[model samples]
Structure formats: structure tokens, C-alpha cells
Target chain A: MTNNTEGRSAFISGGSRGIGKAIAIGLAKSGSNIAINYTRDKEAAQETVAEIEALGKIAKAYQGNVADFEDCQRMVNSALNDLGEISILINNAGVASRGSLITDTNPEEIRKVIGIHVFGTHNLCHLLVPQMRAAERGDVIMISSVATESLSGRGAPYNMAKSAQEAIAFTLAKEEKVHDIRVNIVGPGLVETDMGKRLVKATRGVEDIRELDKGSPFQRVCQPEDIADAVVFFCSEDAAYVTGQRLYVNGGSF
Target chain B: MGELDGRKALVTGGSRGIGRAIVRRLASEGADVVINYHSNQKAAEEIASEVRKLGKKAEIIMADVSDQSEAERLATESITALGSIDILVNNAGIGATAVGRPHVATASPDDFYRLMAAHAFASHDLCRMIVPQMRESTRGDVVMISSIAAQSFGPTGGTYAAAKAAMEAVAYSLAKEERGNNIHVNIVAPGLIETDMAEMMVKFQGRVKDSINELAADSPFGRLGYPEDIAGSVAFLCSERASYITNQRITVAGS
Candidate 1:
């Protein structure tokens, strides 16, 4: 509830749009400077940077592929130079896998999904956590999906990737506690993001995401801000004693 | 203004230790609170006065929630005092030592049932009586203050673990059933907090001859968790900041 992130700096991957952007803005609003990471969409990333700057907080965008360890290193170095002592890392950048069975899916697709979600999370933590150790406190939030819980058929790559990402989160939670670095996971059920729209169109053939609202809890689908709110709470002082935890922002669906 | 301004909360066992900390935290967040205490009227009155000093409504109700009829009365009286319970914190329960932590083979059925009544059944009764009115409110939040014992299920703690686990089941089921009505239900499981209950456990065990502080030196945080640690999570769950969170258990165990 307090401004726990005040005077701190955060580096958020995939932070140009969707849930990542919301988290970036939320942390900025909570008084932290922002370093945004994006795989593509430089214009969208810049827009987010501008929004954070408007809030009187420092903001910058770094273009890099999180799955590439070298690229992650490059981004971390640049962000450290720009932001100085990045203490919060939001592993929000992710790619959804094609909803196909493991046998039917191409190996390349599986690797790409896993690389973005699992390996990408690892690369950031590997780079930023050491600097975080020297700071006052540190927070790592993995923007995982509810797929880890559902494990629905034909979504093996995504489910496996998210499950692995959470495994990293839980392990890091314990490993980093000695250093005052708290690790937690935020799992969101079907949100009205661009990715959600695409998935719905491909699977349910629903053009408008709101059409599924009647079947959704509270008669509405989850929003990027809804997921962001959970991340913000985890980053706040309210969760000072909370770690190695997973909060499902799914309207109690799963 | 506090985030919980205009909200009303009812916290069970709210006179001492973790429950008392929760009462203070919720009141500090601008919520009018109904403090439910089984005994120790002096402690309950002291907490109520503190809340009133914060410019919030504070009322103390006495009832042993483990009794089915007393739980009903607590629910009715809490609503009468606070108008509608926007936040309900089920925190009134005894430590493992109170029920006699014995091996499963030697554990008495009486102790098992007593533990169940004090935790699982008490929570069930309060939720059933309070949730219907919560439906008409803008938002409702229920937080179950369970312990890590429910998950760990360590030796000689079967009765307590079973009761807490059963309470968690109720929390999960209620979360799903009430999500449509904008109600959020979650659990905060604390591990070895520095409370009187924990001290009682330490004294009962007899193996740890050292004081609580010395014993806490080996904990994950190098110190035992404070009562405020558990209260912070409970207050966060009750606020709108956690509106999307439900059917989840956050273990505030440093690890």
C-alpha cells in the first residue's frame, strides 16, 4: 500500500505493450524509474517511455531479444547505464506457442516459446540479480500464465514453457532470499490482450474478446491492468514478507 | 486517504498477536473494524480504542467461534456493528500445543474434532452467514490466515494440519463460487511467526532450549517473522489493489 518502489529503478522486458506496458506504467506510477525492454515495435516502446516520463519518472527503451543471452547482457548493461541500479525485474516478455500437440508441433516453435518464457527469464535474472544483491532490496516478478495450471491438450509448448518458468520462479525465490531478492509469479487467465485476441480468434473463432465475457467471472475478461495490479502489490512493501508465491489473477477461474 | 476507506472488516481473534496486528493494519488503512475475541476483554477493548483513535469505528464482540452457535452470533453481531462485512479475516484458532501435538497413532478423536471445529468449521460458518450480504456490496474480500503446516504436514501436527487444510478447501471453493459477485478469497500462510502461539509451541517442544530470538537466527530471514508481516498481506488482499487475485495462497515465509 505504500510507495515501496520510490527511488528505485525497474527493468521490464516486453514492456512496450499489453501486460508488460501496464506493469511498467504501474511501477512508474508507484514511484520507480523505468527501463523498458522490447523485442520489436520500437514506436510502441517509445510511447510507453513517454508515458512514464510524463509521470516525472525516468524512462528508457532498450531493444533486445530476451531469449538471446548476449542480447540480454547488452540490454542489462545499457539499462544499468541509463537507469542506474535496476532493482526490479519484470519478466513480462513472452511468445505464445501454436496450439498444437507436441508430436504435431514443429521443434522450432517449441524452442522459440520455451526460449522466450523460460530461458529469457533465466537470462535476465542471471544478469540483474548480482547488481540487485548490492542494493537495498530486489524484486523479480515472472508474468506467467494460467496454462501451467490448466495444462490443456494441444498447448504442450505453452504449458511446458510456463511450467518451467514457474519452476525457475519458485527456485529463485528460495535461492535469492538470502540476498534480499524476492521472487514471485503472477499468473493471469485469459486477458483481453492482443495475444488473447489472436488466441480466441484462432481457437474459439470469436472476433470480439468481450463476447466471452458472459461466460467469464464478473462477466468480464481479465485486463492487462488487472494483471499489473497484482505485480504492483508484489513489488510493494505490503508483500515484504511474501516470497516464493504464485498469485493467479484469473477471477478465481482456476 | 487510505485505500480501504469506507470499508468494514471483521477480524477474529483480533485481540492479540497476529489478529491484533491485522486489526491495527486494517484500521490504519481507514477501515472500520469489528474485533472478535473469545476472551481477554481488556485486550479487545484496548485494540478497539486504538482503532477509534485512528478516526475509524471500532467495536469488540465476544464469542468462541469454534462453537457453531457462537460463530453465528459473531457473524450477526459483526454485521450489526459494522453494517456489512466487506472484509472478513478468519484468524481465531489455537496453536498445535493447545490440542496436544501427538503422533497420528496416538492422536485423540476429540482433539481432531476440536481442531476442526475451531478452524475449518468456524470459517465455514462465518462465510455462509456473511457472504450473502457481501454479494450486494461493491466488493468483498475474505482472507484465511492459515499456516505453512497445512502444506508441510510435519510430524506430530496432523490434527492442526488437517484443520488448516480443510479451512483452505473452504476458501478455495468459496472463491470460485463468489467470483461472479466480485468477491475475492485468498489465503495467507505464515511460517513460524514471532507470536505468543509460536512461543507456546517452542516452550512445549522442549528441544529448543534457546530463546525465540536465538532460535530465529537460523530462519530464512535471520529473524522470525513479525505479526505485522502476516497482517500486511491480509490488508493487501482486502484492498482493491488485489481485486483480480483469488483462490490463491501466498506463503509469507521469506522463502
Candidate 2:
């Protein structure tokens, strides 16, 4: 295996911890200067940078909410300022909640989820895409969910939002082909991470959900690093000529 | 410039063997590779170290592919993390006889069907949902891996073969339907590979008699295909190099 991030730079959103943090570290380990974006985890973000620097690769923490468009733009611009142009963007930042049933959910809460899950993702693409097109080569990946397909319940708003984000990703991949930017989606099943554990708890409350799991006969749930590995592959050359596709990274849990 | 210089690919079930070889191959060519596994984040990290040695960026992901909701989440999250997905390798599959339709005569029917649906049919379901995007943008290619079992017929191999066959038919029909659109869809039906699954098949009930190399040499190629060998074929199909190839099955067997 060869590490080519040597001269490359990558800027990823929601990259401070969890799957994002793992991906940042992986890229740094591969030799790319990394720009880690986080909403409020300053210390965690710095720690991620420290890890990247430890790898002898340059890393900078870019603070911003993954919920705001302006923040997304600023985050991208700042990363470019520090590391030239980003060759890849891993959209790993996302949020999950304990609330269920949209009828009982607050409107503000819905906005929070949609803003970070969808809009924040959009903001970065809007700014970074043009530069990638100009370069005639770039990759755009959207961190999606199995909820969009398994839409079991109360995941309604979240599912719709992710579906919309996927729409934008496909649209960009289709339209941007003239410039050669590839747009794709990565779908992962349950992982053992904070986000995944939260879901396991949310639905494990239901008999059918638990039964569904056993019925599937899957192995261990999964981990953040698992999802990050998928990210690294999507950004790699092996996937060249692969565009406008969604890669599901679940164990046999499907 | 290969359409993938700045591109990224996330291959689930990618690790030592086919997945690992895929990571090395992709990274060697210039695109970054993210190696994913179910339990071995350490192995994933080690694979990361290997990919790093190539100067190509690599990441490790532990997301399980079967959890439907998580499936969508992971896909979206990855798309966000990398700017785009030029290739999607739905290589994440499990080989299981424990939960299968083995024609055991005593095995429960449900176990048989579920086994096929989970491993063989699932990836197509993924492509069914994910390929429209690929179609919408640049030229898209989906390489679904199937075993010679997909059509081997009858008895203990019932469920696995049926499910794989179903997926391949789906891939072939879809390939034919989308051929005009330039969305290339193909299948690599590996008769005998060095994977554990192959080893198990060879040992199962004397189904494959002879040593691994003895069986491998049975193929027209005079040797068994390695993961890297198959990886090369897959990468080519996804490259501009195979622009004219679509809707076909390329069987790798030694003569």
C-alpha cells in the first residue's frame, strides 16, 4: 500500500470526532495536510490536529457549526487558505436525537437536525465545487443513512432530509461531469459509535426492531473507523470512473 | 489524467485479500482508498498504514452494511467526507451456511431464503437506489461479484446460488436497460478464488476435490485468480479503459 496524501490536502466537515475524527487521522496518516471542522468540540478538534501533526503532516482546526451555510463557507475558505485547495471532502458530521414521532417533536428541533444534516453539507459543496471543477478533478461525498431506506418510523424528517442531500449529490455528479468531479454517497449500517449506539437505544426499545436485528444474524454492529475506511476508498483512485453511486458499508446487518 | 486523480472510493468488506488488494490497487493508481471492515478496526488501521506507504490517502470504516438505516447514514456521511464517489464497490458480503437454504431436507425454509437475501440480493438493492445518481452524472459502472454458484443448481447450494443468480440477472437486465445511457454494469463470476469461502467450498462434502492449487490449475488460466488479479479487472471496467464494455459477465478461470 502506498500513501499519496503526501502532497495532497483534504478539508472535511464535522471532522472533530467520531467517524469524522477517524477519517481526518486516516488522511493525515496518508500524508495529506488536514483541516478538521467541528461545531463546538474545540479540545477534541485540537487533539485531532495534534494527532495529524504527530504523523508529521500539517493539520489545522477550523471551528464552525455544521448547521449554518455561512459557517460551512468560512470553514472551506479557511481550510483552502491554510492548505491550498482541498482535493477531497468527507461529509462525516451528522446528528441523531432521542426524540421520536414528528407530531410530538418541536419545530425548532426539526430545524436543527435538517440544518446540520442537509444545509451545512450543502454550504461546503457550494463553495468547494467550483474550484474542483476548475481543477477538472474532484470528489464530493455525502454521509448518508440506511434510515433513508429502512425508514422504520419517526426517522421521517431525517430520512427526507438525507434523501434531499442525496439528490443534490446526484445532481452535482451528473451536471459536473463536464468538469470531471465525481459525486457519490456512502451508506453505513449500525456502528458501535455514539451516533449508532444512540439509534440502537432508540429502537431497541421496540420488540420488532430487536427481533429484526436477530433475524438478520449480523456480526458485531460496527465502529467509526469502519465508516472512515469507506470514506478513504471513495476518495481513492480505485473508484475512478465510479460516480453518482451510493456505497452501503454495513455488516451483514442489512 | 485518469478520471480519478482527486477521486475517492469506499469499498466495504475491503481488507486483507480482495478488499485489501483493492485498496492497494486504487491507491497505487492515484485515488485515495478507504478500507472498511466489520470488527477489525485494528486491521483496518493496519491497512491504512499499508495504503499510507503508497503515498495515497487511506481511512478505515467499521460500519456494518446490513443495518438498513445505518446503511443510508453511512453512505451520506461518506459522500460528505469525500467530495465525490467515482466508484462504488458493494463488495461487503458474508458467506454463511449456518443460516441458509442448504437443501438439508431438515433446514427451515426461512433460514434458507434469508441467507440469500442478506448477502447476495442486498448489494443490488443498494445499487438500485444508488445507481440513478451515477447515471445522472458521469459514466457509471457497477461490478457485482457473484460465484459460479449463482447458477450451479440444486441441492445444498440452493439458497446461495439462487440469491446470487437473482442478483446477477438483475445486474444483467439493468445493464442491458441502461446500456444506451452508458452506465456499464457487469459481473465477475469467480469460479475458484483463494478466499476462505473458496476454501470452505472446496472442503464442503468433497464438493471440490484436490489441493487448492490443484483445483486452481483446473481453470483455463493455469492458476487460480488472486484478489489483486480480480481487482485489476474491476478497476479496468470502471476506468475509461473499459468504456466500450458493458452488460457482460467475465468469468475468471484457469484453463
Best by DockQ: 1
Please give, for residues B1-255, the per-residue lDDT of candidate 1 as tens digits. 998999999999999999999999999999999999988999999999999999999999999999999999999999998889989999999988997798778889998889999999999999999999999899999999999999999998988999999999999999988988899999999998888888889878884675666677787757788999998888878877777778889898887
**Candidate 1: TM of chain A?**
0.98
On TM-score, the candidate that comes out on top is 1
Give DockQ: model 2: 0.01
- Model 2 spans with C-alpha error above 4 angstroms: A205-218, B1-255
Each candidate's interface RMSD (Å, one decimal) is 1.5, 15.9
Task: Please write out the lDDT profile of model 1 over residues A1-254, one tens digit for every residue.
Answer: 56368999999999999999999999999989999999879999999999999999999999999999999999999999988998999999998888888789999998999999999999999999999999888999999988888899999889989999999999999898988888999999999989999999999999999999998877788899988888988988878878898888887855
lDDT of 1 at B123: 99
Worst 10 residues of 2 chain B by lDDT: B246-255
lDDT computed for candidate 1: 0.91
* Fraction of native contacts (fnat) of each candidate: 0.76, 0.00
Q: What's model 1's lDDT at A156?
A: 89
**lDDT, candidate 2, at A58:** 89
lDDT of 2 by residue, A18-119 (tens): 778888887777667888888787998899888888889889998888777777777787888988878777776788754578777777777887888788
Q: Quote the positional error of residue B175 for candidate 1 in Å.
A: 1.5
Count: clashes, candidate 2? 108
